[model samples]
Target: MAAVRDSSFERQAPEADAEELARRHLVQPWPYAGSIGSEARGLIGSGDGIYVTDGEGRRLIDGPAGMWCVNAGHRREELAGVMYEQAMRLSYNTPWYTMNEPSAVLAERIAAHAPGDLSHVFFTTGGSSAVESALRFMQFYNNVRGWPEKKLLLSRGGAYHGSTYLSASLNGRPRDRDWMDVADGLVVKLSSPDPFRRPEGMTVEAFADQLVDEFAETVARIGADKIGAFVGEPVQASGGVIVPPPGYLPRIREICRDNDILYVSDEVVTGFGRLGEIFASQDVFGIDPDIITFAKGVTSGYFPLGGMLVSERLLADLRRSNHPDAMYAHGLTYTSHPVGCAVALANLDLLEGGILDHARAVAPYFQERLKTLEELPLVGEVRGVGLMACVECVADRESNDPLKLDYEVGKRIDAHCHSLGLLVRPLIHMCVMSPPLIISRSQIDDMVAILREGISRTMDDLATEGVWQG
Candidate 1:
C-alpha cells in the first residue's frame, strides 16, 4: 500500500528544533522525576488510516491506535467534516443552564445502544471525568438515600479506571499508585480475574468460582450495606488486556444486584467497536450495569468527550427519594459540548454504517494472528478478545515470571518495532496491541510479523547482555 500523507499537518518547526522546544516547554502525562519536564517523545507528524508518519518520516502502523481511541482510524474525513460543520453552526454552548441539540441527539442515540434501562447520559470532558462523575454520583445517591456511610467502592487488582482523584484511586496496576496518594478508606480491592495468573494446576472454571467467592466473602465480611458500587473494565484494557474467565462477569453482576451495590462498567477502552460492540456489558458479557462510563472511541479521538449512561431504575429511585430538592452538584465546563457531540454523531454513523460489521468479521483473525507470537520463547502469553490483545514477556516459560529489568523488555521491543515501521504501547513487561478497527488482514499480518521480529531481536539483546537465556 502507498503511504498516505496530510499536508495540512505539516510540521511548523524542524524535527531537531521541535524536539528541543518540547523538552523545554511541554510536560507530558505520566512523567518520571528523572526526566519530568526535560523529555521529548517520538514525534508523530501525521496519520492516515492505520499508519502514522513520525517526525523522522518513518511510516509506522498505529499499534495502540492513539492510546486505543482512534477506532475510526486517523484522518477520517467524515469525523473531521462533522466537527467543522458543527463548530460553524454552534461551536460552544454552556451546558450548565442551557443545552444543545447535538448532545441530546447523541444521548438518545447512545441510550438506544445501551443495555437495560440506561436511558440517561451525563457528559464530561473525557474518561477521567466520566468515571469521576459516576463515582461522585454513587456517593450522592447513597447520601440522598440516607446512607452516607455506604460509600466504599469495590475495584479489582488489574484495573485502570481513570486519572482523577477518586477514579485514580481505583487503579490497580502495580506502578500506577506508587508515588500517588488516593482515598484509601473509600475503596476496596478484589483479586484480578486474570486467568493467566490463576493459581497453578487450577482449572479456569475453578478460578472463576474462586474469584466469585472472594467477592461474596468480601461483601459478607464488610457488609454490603457499606458498599456503594463496583467499578471494572469488561476486558481490563491497560491491565494487560486481561479477559476474565467465562461466566465471571454475569455472576459478579448478579452479586452486585442482590447486594444493592451498583455495577459500573468502565468501557473507556472496550466501547466503540474495539470489542466489536458499542457497549460490551450486555451484548458481549451478558450483564447490564447500573452505570457505564465511556470515552476514547466515542468520537474516534477526534474530540475529547465522554459520559456515563445511567439506568432508568436508578434515576427513578432518585426521583422518588425524599430529598427531592437535592442536587448531584457535578458538572464540567465542557459538558455536552456541541462540536464534540456532533463529531460523535458522525462517528456513530460511520460505525453503524459498516465499520462495526468489519470489526466483528476481522476480530477473530486479528486475535489469531497475534496469538501466534506466543510461539516465541520470550512471550509468556498472547491473549485478548475482539481486536484488543496483549503480549506478555516472562523471564522463563515455566514460572511465567516477569523480567527483573522492569519495563525494559517492552520498551526494547517497542524500539525495535518502531524502527521496523510499527508503533507499540509498552505497558511495563507487556506490549498491548489494539490497532485501529479499520486494520485489514494484510495489515494484521504485517503488525504481527514486525512484532515477532521485534521480540526475537529483544531476546537476542537480552542474551547478549546476560539478562536471560532461552
Candidate 2:
C-alpha cells in the first residue's frame, strides 16, 4: 500500500514528474541553495500589488518587498508591456563597445537620480555581480591607480553585501557565514551600529566612535598599506535592520579617508527611495562614497538588472590606464542586458513620477503605526525609517534576552499573520518589514492590525503552553 501511494505521488507533476525531479533532485535549489534544505519550500504562482498567490492557491502579503527589491508593487501591467516590447525589439547587445539605446537612457536617468558625482554607470546582471564588480574595481583601482599593497576590505559585523564569492565574504553576519565555515582572507568585520545587543548604556554616538576605532585598529593591525577599501551598507539591511548612529557613516567615511582607502556603499537595499531618499548615504549620512552599488529597486526586481555608480576618480583611472590591449578584465556576459535595461528604465520612471512621493508622505504614518506595537508584551524594539522597519522580540525588557529556544513566539506571530493573509519574515529575533513604495494607508493599517493580532495570539499561545506564565 505504501509503495502504491508513493508511485501515485511520483506520477503527479506540473510539467511532468521528470521536470519536478529535475528541480528537486538536480538543481542547486534556485536563488538560495540552502533555504529549502533538501527539498522545495513554498511555490508561488503569481503576485498582485502587495500579495503573492502560491501554487496551492494561498494568498500572502509580500512583506519584505520581494526580498527588499521590488520597490514598486507586483503585477505591474505597464512594466509588463515594456518588457514585452523590449524583448521583441532588441533582445541582446554587447554593452562593452557597442552600447544600446535602452542602456544609455537608463544610465542617464540613474546618474541624474543618484546622489553626488556618482555619474558614471557600470552594469551587472544583479546585486551579487554589482557588489562583486565594485569590490574588484576597488582592488583594480588600488593596483592600477595606486597602492597595490592595499587589498584588504573592511565591513561591519552584520552586513549582507551579496552571495558571490567576494561579496558574501564581505558580509558580517554569522548566519550568512555559518555553513560557509571560512573567511576568504581579504575581508575584515567590525562592530555594527546596533545598540540592541552591544555593551550597556552605549549611546549611538559611542557606537559610532567604537566603529571608527575598531576600523582604525584593524587598519593598524593589517598595516593600512594592505587595505584597499572599506565597504558597508549605509543602513545595514540583513543585519537585523541595523541603523547607524547619528554621525555613524560620516565618522566611518572619515576613518576610511584618513587611512587612504576607498569607501564603497552597498545600496542594494537602501537605494532607490527605500530610505525616502534616492541614495541613503548622501541624503541621510552626508558622506560621499568612492563607489556605490545598487540593485533591487533599479528594476523593482522586474528583470534582474543592477549596476554601480562609479565616481570620476575610478572612471578616469580606468580610461587612462585601460588601454586597448589591457583586459580591464571584468564584466558579466549579461552586462547591460537590453531587455532588462528597458524594464529598469520604465521602473525608474514610475519611481520618480509619483511612487517616491507616496513613500515619503506615508513613511511617517507607517512609522507611527509600527510604534503602536510597543504596547505588545513581546515587542522589545521597533526601529526603522522610510518603508523599512523591524520589531525585535524579547523575553525580558532589561537584558533584551531573546526567546531563542523555540521560535514559537516568533513562529506563532508569523503563522498567525500568515493565516490572516499578511506575510511576515522572522530574521534572527525580529520581524522585518519592507513593503512596496506603492503601499497605501489602508494596506499599511491592514498589515499593522494583523501584526497586532499576531502578537496577541503569539503571547496567548506561549502562555497556554507554559512558556509565558506572565
For model 1, residues 188-226, the per-residue Cα lDDT tens digits are 999999998999999999999999999999999999999
Off by over 4 Å in 1: 1-11
Cα-based TM-score, every candidate: 0.98, 0.91
Candidate 1 collision pairs: none
Top-scoring candidate (lDDT): 1
Predicted model with the maximum TM-score: 1
- Tell me the lDDT of model 1 at 280: 93
The per-residue C-alpha lDDT of model 1 at residue 167 equals 98
lDDT of 2 at 358: 93
The per-residue C-alpha lDDT of model 1 at residue 207 equals 100
* 1-470 per-residue lDDT for model 2 (tens digits): 01111124444455344446655675443335554434454556679998888666788878888889888899887787788888877889776678789988888888886666789898998888999999888877777765677898888787888888899898887767767744568877778778677688887667667877887788889887898888888888877788777887887788788878888998989998898777888877788888899988888888988899988866777678745344558988789889999998888888888988899999999989999999887788998888999998888877888776455466668778888877787785678899888889999999899889988888888788787654
**lDDT computed for candidate 1:** 0.94
